[model samples]
Every structure is written in C-alpha cells, then in structure tokens.
Target chain A: MKTQHEVEQFLYRQAELLDSKQWQAWIDLFTDDGVYWMPPEPSHRTWEGMPAIFAEDKNLMRVRMGRVLHPDAWSQRPLWGTNHVVSNVVIVKSSTNEVQVRSRFHMMELRRDDVRHYAGAYTHRLKKTRGGYRIKLQRVDMTNAQAAYDYVLQVWV
Target chain B: MLQERIPDFSKFVEPDRVRKEVYTDAGVFEREMERIHETLWIYCGHESQVPKAGDYYAVQLGRQPMLMVRGPEGKVHVLYNRCPHRGNMMCGDRHGNTGEFFRCSYHAWTFHHDGRLRNIPMMESGYQGTRYGRDNPECSMKRAARVESYRGFVFASLAKDGPTLKEFLGASLVAFDDMCDRAPEGEVEIVPNCFRIIQHSNWKIFLENQLDALHPSVTHQSTGRAAHEVEKMIEKKTGKAPLSYHMLSAFATVTIDKWDNFQTINHPQGHCILTGYMGLRPKDPDTLKYEKTLIKAYGQKRMEEILGVNIHHVLIYPGLSVQSPLQQLRAVRPLGVDRTLTEIWHFRLKGAPEAIYRRSLAYYNLVNSPATVVNADDLENFWKCHQGLSSDGGDWVSFARHFGRDIEKDGVVESGPGMGTSEAPMRNQMKAWARYMGNGK
Candidate 1:
C-alpha cells in the first residue's frame, strides 16, 4: 500500500507539471485508457448521452495539447501562465491496485495582463501500474460550470 | 446624449460600406432593440424542450422577459414572465414546471400555464368592484403578439401585425426542413442544456461571421493544420484516422479558392444560406448502419432525397444560425452595445443510430464548444474587432467583396459564378436592417 505522504507527493508533482506547462510530462501521467472530463453542469453525473465542457480520450487530448503548443495557435500566441494550487486532499476509496482521490483546485491564469480565477473540485481515479500510479479518470467539476463565460476556457482545469 | 448624436440611418449604411457606429454606437443598439428585435419574429425554445405540460423555459425577446410554457391543454404559449398583480416575475428559474399553473412568489397570484388568471389571494373580497377581474385580459399575464411553430421550432413576435412566420421565413424555412428531413422520425429533440457564451462584440458581428467563408482558412488555420499533421501521422502509423480528424483537417485542406465554389444565397428578409462543401457522407460501418436505418424508416427513394439535401449554414436574419447538416444551432441575444450572449445547442436525429448522434456531438464539442480551438480563435477575433471598431482605427466596415456581382431577381440575391466569397450576405443584412430601421423597404 502507498502511504498518504507518497500519494500527496504524487498529487503535488502533477500540479507542478501543469503549472510549469509540461505538456508531455502531464500526458505521461495518464494511463493508456485514461479519461479526462469536465461536466457542463454540476448536476451532470455521467458523460454518456450528454455534452461536456471536455470529455477527452487519449487521441482528443493529443489533439488539444498539440493545438495549444503549436506555434500558429493565435489564441495562445501570448501563452497563458497559470498557477495551480491543489489542496484538501482526501482519499475517497482505495483498493489493492486502485485508489480514488478528491481534491480542491484553485487555478489562476494570467494572459495579456488579464487574470482569471478558476476554482474546481477534482475527482481522480488512479491505478497502480508497473512504472507508477497513473490516472484512470480525472473529473473536474468547475464552480461556474453552467454559467455563461466571457472568453474561451483555453486550458484544462 | 446619444439620441441627438445618432447619425442618420440612410447615411450610415451604403451599398458597399457601413458606418462603424452601427456596430459600436449605444444609440443604434437601443434603436435596434426597439425597431428590429422587438418587431421581428424571434425564436423561442423548441416544443420538445417543454414536452410535458407546465414545463416552461424563460427567454428574452428584445428587452422583454418572457416564458415559453406547455399549457395543460398541450399547447405551447409564449407569455410575459411578469405577473399582472405586482409585476413580479413568475418564473425565475431558467426552466421548470410551475405545477399546472404559474404562481407568483411575491403576491400568491396563481396563473394557468397559458397565462390566464387561475386564482389570486382574497380576490373576491379585495377587488369586488375594483378594475382587477379574472375576465379582464389586462389582469392576466400578457402574451406575445403572435406565437407559431414551424415543425416543432417555436417563434414569437412582439409586433401586432407583420408577416406571418412562414412568410418571413420564406426560402429560409429550408433550415428546419433540412434538419427534420434527416431524422427518420421527422423530428428532433434538444440535447437538454446548451453552452451559454458571451461574445464581446455586436450581435451583428457574430451573425456576419457565420456566413463569412474567407475567415475560417485564415483564423482557424492553426487548429486545422495541427489536426491535419496528427491525422497524417495517424494515417501513416495505422493506415487510417477517424472521421473526426477529417472534420477539423478540412479547414486546412479546403483552400481559400475552393470556398468560391460553395454559393451563398441571400434572401429578401436578410436570411442567407450557404451550400455544403464538407463530405459528410462517409461509407464507414457506422454511417452505413445509420443509412440502413434511414432506408428502413423511409423508402429508398425518399431516403436518398433526405440525404441529398446539402446545406452548410443558414443565417436566419437577426438571431439564429443553423447548421442543419450537423444538427447544431446558435441563438444570439444582444445584451449591450458591446456584449452579446449566444446559446449553442445541438440536436439528436430521432430514430437514427447512436453513432450518428455521436458524430453530431463530436462536431458540437470539437468545433462549436467554447473550449474548442476553432471557436476560441473566432472569439478572440470578435473581441479584437470590437476593440478596433470602438477606437478611431477605422470608420467604415467594408462589404465590397464582389459587390454588384450578386444576381438579384424577385428580391432574392445569389452570388455570381465563382463568387461564394462574396460579401452579399452582409450587404443584404444591412439592407434589411435599413428597412427595419424605417429607412427603406
């Protein structure tokens, strides 16, 4: 069994990767069949038969990351500098080879002298592999998920 | 201050150029709300949105807060959200059932789903001879001037007299027909909620961009090129890439000159239609399965006819843009001179396979969603355009591309040969705007 300290360290490392815009490293943290999801509404319980802010499999994630990192992505021409702070970690469930962790995230993104605050709760289901623990599913429920947004949500929560 | 400074409408709009104030001036925006939006036939929610009786969806028509409700008699009614008693809004939530009647939280005034007065507290004793009475139409919730539905899509007009919804739709009714005809059951249901996005530009700017074919290659080139590279890699590695990649890659592969082949038909009422260019018919297993189902529901000949209707985007005058082929729609509501709210909704083809529905959903997510790379660039351009127009950077917005090349006959304009990149749609819209602004017919 992995100790709570070990799991917390792992979580912090993931946040560090995202904050540093380490796209390849962040992608490597996901399992072969991993899923990343952000529901359109807080009440949305499932991704099946409904729309999502983001419901990306590996291929879709690859496309998204490629677009964001591409030189010609004009929207990202002045790249966003983000700080992701993950806190209030709790182990929701644990099994012999898998665990589900819940955490609160406060992400502040700065672009072109404008700063936007994004707060969300993340539910991550991780599975222990031969190399290390990898994400099976990462579901982000943004506080303003259903509200009308002024601009595009360029990056993942 | 703005009223006196308001420029003459005729002087502001010409054949090839429009004054920037039409897009940036607060006075022009107010006049638009009063003259164009309030007088026109504005779209309400679909009937399927309120399938059950008493189900209601609150909407904004011009400056009025209204509710589209399914009455107990199974009829849809568009009524003002305000209660007649104290003018308190009856339905505060975006959508919900008010039981069989709408009850005011402030005054305990009860109304039927059709906006008739059902009951009021102490009415018999409190207003025995007062002006308030159940039979008086003024005492009940007010209704729109006209309410009509074209194939389950409801629209309401606030003006008492004008063209009927059909007359107004004219050739543009093809938008709904093309969508419903694709459904084996000849109807569609909304996919519950929609993505509500606020664009920091004039509503006209958003509408104009819908039929603008030249901007996609320039604005969305990054996303398209990225997808194309990945698509080629996947094809090299696995001998094939999914159809979704093609949807994105087409943006890059379809060069700017090729856009001229797809014609834009401009109608009299400011509505415009763009013919399809994307190859939606793939003979993949999923598509074949969907085609088989369609063939079974509709005979072979009818199925062929249904599938043969090629449409890319239909701009319905001042508000809606419908992509019938993909079952996607966007409704625009102007909030201010520089602020506009757009509701992006996608539909499911009834009696079609789940795979077909997934295709629509994929397009919705990959192309139209606020988080999408394609839409993000467009939003940035819209904001930049608004900022530039608001500044002294320019005075006139040009629509002179292929000017005087549009073939006009019976008040309908069609792009000339190899002129699909024409700005006829924008010019036609401004002409209609001028008429609606009480300048010209």
Candidate 2:
C-alpha cells in the first residue's frame, strides 16, 4: 500500500504539470481508459442520460488539447493561466491495484483583464501501476456549477 | 425616468445598417423589452417540465418574473411570480412543488396552483372592509394576458392584445414540429436541468449568429481543424471514428465557400431558417433502429417525409433559437444592454432509442457546452463585439453582405441564388426591431 504522503506527492506533481500548461504530461497521469467528467450539478451522478459540462475520454481530451494549443485559437490568444491549490487530501479507500482519493481544490484562473476563482471538490479513482498512480476517473464537482457564468469556461476546472 | 427626447428608431435602424447604439445603449434595450420581448409571445417552458401538479418552473420573460406551473387539473398556468398583496414574490426557488397550494413565505397568504386566492391569514378580520377578497381579481396572483401551448411547448404573451402564438410563430413553428415528430411517440420531453450562460453582449448578436451561416468557418476553424486531425488519425488506426468527432470536424471539412450552398429563408417576422447541412441521417445500427421505430410508428413514407424536412436551425425572432434537428433550444433573456442570459436546454425524444438521445447529447456537450472550444470562441467574439460596439470607433454595424441580392416575395426574403452567406437575417431582424420600436409609446 502506498503511503498517504506518496499519494499527495503524485497529486501535487499532476497539479504542477497542469499549471505549467504541460497538457500532454498532465493527461499522461490518467490511465488509458480514464474518463474526466464535469457534470453541471453535483446531483448529476452519470453523464450518460443527462447534460454535462464535460465528459471526455482520453481521446477527446487530446482533441481538446490540440485546439487549446493551436495558434489560431482566438480564445487562447491572450493565453490564460491557472494556479491550483490542492489540499485536504484524503485516501478514502485503497486496494492492491486501485485507490479512491478525495481532495478539495481552489483554482484561480487569469484570462485577459479578469481573474476568476473556481473552487471544487475532486474525487479521483486512481489505478496503481508499476510506475505510479494513474487516474481512472476524475469527477469535478464545482462549487459554482449552477452559476450564470459571464462567459464560457474554455479550460478544465 | 423619461428621456427628454425620444430618439427616432427609424434613423438608428436602416435597411442594411443599424446604429451601434441599438446594441450598446441602455435606452434601446429598455425599449426592446417593452416593444419586442414583453409584447411578443415569448417561449415560457415545455409542458413536460411541470408534469406534476403544483410543480412550478420560474421563468423570466423580458423584465417580468413569471412562473409556469402545472395546476391540479393538468392545466399549465403562466402567472406573475409576485403576490397580489405587498408585491412579495410567491416562489423563491427556481422550481419545486408548491404542494396543494402556494403558501407565501411572507405573511402566510395561500393561493391555489392556478393563482386563485384560496385564503389569506385572518381574511375576515384583516380584510373585512378592504377591497381585497376572493371576489376581486386583484386579490389573486395576476395571470399573463395570453398563454398557449402547441405540441407540448408552451409560450406566454404579456401584452393584452397582439398576434396569437400560432401567428407569431408562423413558419418558425416547424422548430417544435420537427423536434416532436422525430420521436416515434411524436413528443419530446425536456431533460431536467439546463446550462445557463450569461454573455456580456447584446441579445441580438446571439440571435443574428444563429442563422449567420458565415461565421462557423472563420471563428471555429482552429477547434475544427484540431478535431479533424484527431478524427483522421483515429480513422486511419481503427478504420472508423465516432460520430461525435465528426460533429466537431465538420466545421473544418465544410469550408467557408461551401456554406454558401445552404439557404436562409428570412421571414418578415424576423424568424429565419437555415437549410440543413449536417446530413444527420447516417446508416449506423443505432440510427437504423431509430428509423425502424419511427417507421413502425408512422408509415415508411410519412417517416421519410418527416425525417427529410431540410432544416438546420430556426431563429424565433427576438427571444428563442431552436435547433430542432438536434432537439435543443436556447432561450435568450436580455438582462441589460450588454448582459444577456441564455438557457440552453436539450430534450429526449419519447420513443427513440437511447443511443439516438446520446447522439443529441454529444452535440449538446461538444458544440454547446460552456467548456467546449466551439462555444468558447463564439463567446469570445460576442464579448469583443459588445466591447467594440460600446466604443466610439464606429457608428454603424454593417449588415451589407449581398445587400440588394436577396429576393423578397410576399414579405418572405430568400437569399439570392448561391448567396447563402447573405446578411438577410440580420437585416430582417433589425427591420422588425424598428417596427416594434416605432409602434411602442
């Protein structure tokens, strides 16, 4: 069993990759069949039958990365940046090859002249492999999921 | 507050160009609420949303806070959200069951689901000599001047008199018809919640973009190209790619000039329809099953006729934009001159296969979700447009593309041959806006 400190280290490294705009490296933290879901509400348990903010597999994530990194993507022209503070790490359950971890995150995103704060609870089902932990599923429950946002959320929360 | 001089709308709104004030001025937005959104028949909500008795969905039509609630006897009523006494709002939450009757959180005044007064606390002692009583209409929650539902989709008009809901919808009624008819059960129900986005742009900018047919290639090129690249790579490796990838890639594959092949019928009522270009009828197993279900419901010939209704989008004048083919619609509620609230709602076809619903869900998430790059770029442009319009760099916003080339027949304007990118829709909308503004006091 991996220690709680070791799991925290893995999460911090993942957050570092995302903050540096290393999308591919951040995506590599996920297992091959991993899913990232951002449902509109916390009550939305599944993405199959209802609407979701994002419910992308690795393939779609790669596609999204491609768009965000593209030169002509106007929304990225001014190039937003995010600083993620991941704390309150708790290992809820663990098994030989898998563990479920929960954490609270506050991401302050800067785009153009505005700074938006997104705080959320992240529940990650991590798959333990020879190398390290890989995310099987990451569910983001945004605190302001129902807010009438000023504009589109271009990047992942 | 009254303006010293009423600005002439005729000068601001011309045939092919409208003054920037039309979009940037708060005064114009106020006039729009009075003359356009409040006066016209605005879409309230589908009957399916408030299916159970006492179930209420709060909706904002123009500036009025209203409620669309299902009464005990299965009638859906659109009433003012305010209480008749003391002007307190009846329902505070977005939507919920008010139980047997609506009991005001303040002062414990109760009313039936139909907005009729049931009883007021200490009615005999408190209101014995007052005009407030069950016999007086003022004692009850005020109802909208007109409420009508067509094929399960309800709409309400605040003004006492005007064109009926059917007349207002006109050719645009096909939006609902196309959506409901596609289902084997001939109905579509609203999926529980919606994505509410507040854009920092005028409401008209969003409406104009609905049938513009010219911005997809320019604005979404980067996102589309990226999806196309991934789709091709997947196709090369697996010999096939999912249809969801095609939904994004189509923006890149369908070049700018090819958009000219699709036509827009710009109605005088400001309603517009863009000819279908997505070619949604793929012969996959899921689609085939859905087709079989539809055939069993309606005869094969009728099913084909229903499926072959060439429509990509329908812009319902000043407030609603419907993509019936995909079973989604966006209701535009202008919050202010530069702030607009849009409710994006998707529906499930009653008798279609679950996989078919998934297809529409894919489009809803990929193309319309706030996180999607397609919508992100569009929103960026909308914000930029509003910012620029508020500046003094330009006075008029041009709608001059193919200006004189549109053919008008019996008040319906159609783009000239091979002129699908014409600005006829924007022109038609502004013409209607001018008429509505001119008619108002």
- Candidate topping DockQ: 2
Best by TM-score: 2
TM-score of chain A of each: 0.94, 0.95
lDDT of 1 by residue, B1-441 (tens): 655565579788999999999999898899899888888999988999998998999899888999999988899999999989888998889888889788899989898888889898999998899888887888889999999999999999999999999999989999999998889898998988789889889999998999898888888887788789889988999999878899998778889998888889999799999996567788889888878888999888998888888789899989999999889899898999999999889999898889888889988888777677688888889988998999998899999999999999999999888998999999999998987886333
Q: What is the Å distance of residue B147 in model 1 from its true position?
A: 0.7
* lDDT (Cα, tens digit) per residue for candidate 2, span B34-152: 88889899999999999999999999999999999999899999999998888999999999999999998888889998899999999999999889888998989999999999999
Model 1 CA deviation exceeding 4 Å by range: A42-45, B1-7, B439-441
Count clashing residue pairs per candidate.
0, 0
Best by lDDT: 2
DockQ-based CAPRI category assigned to the predicted complex of candidate 1 = medium
lDDT of 1 by residue, A76-104 (tens): 87657889899988999888899899999
Candidate 1 colliding pairs: none
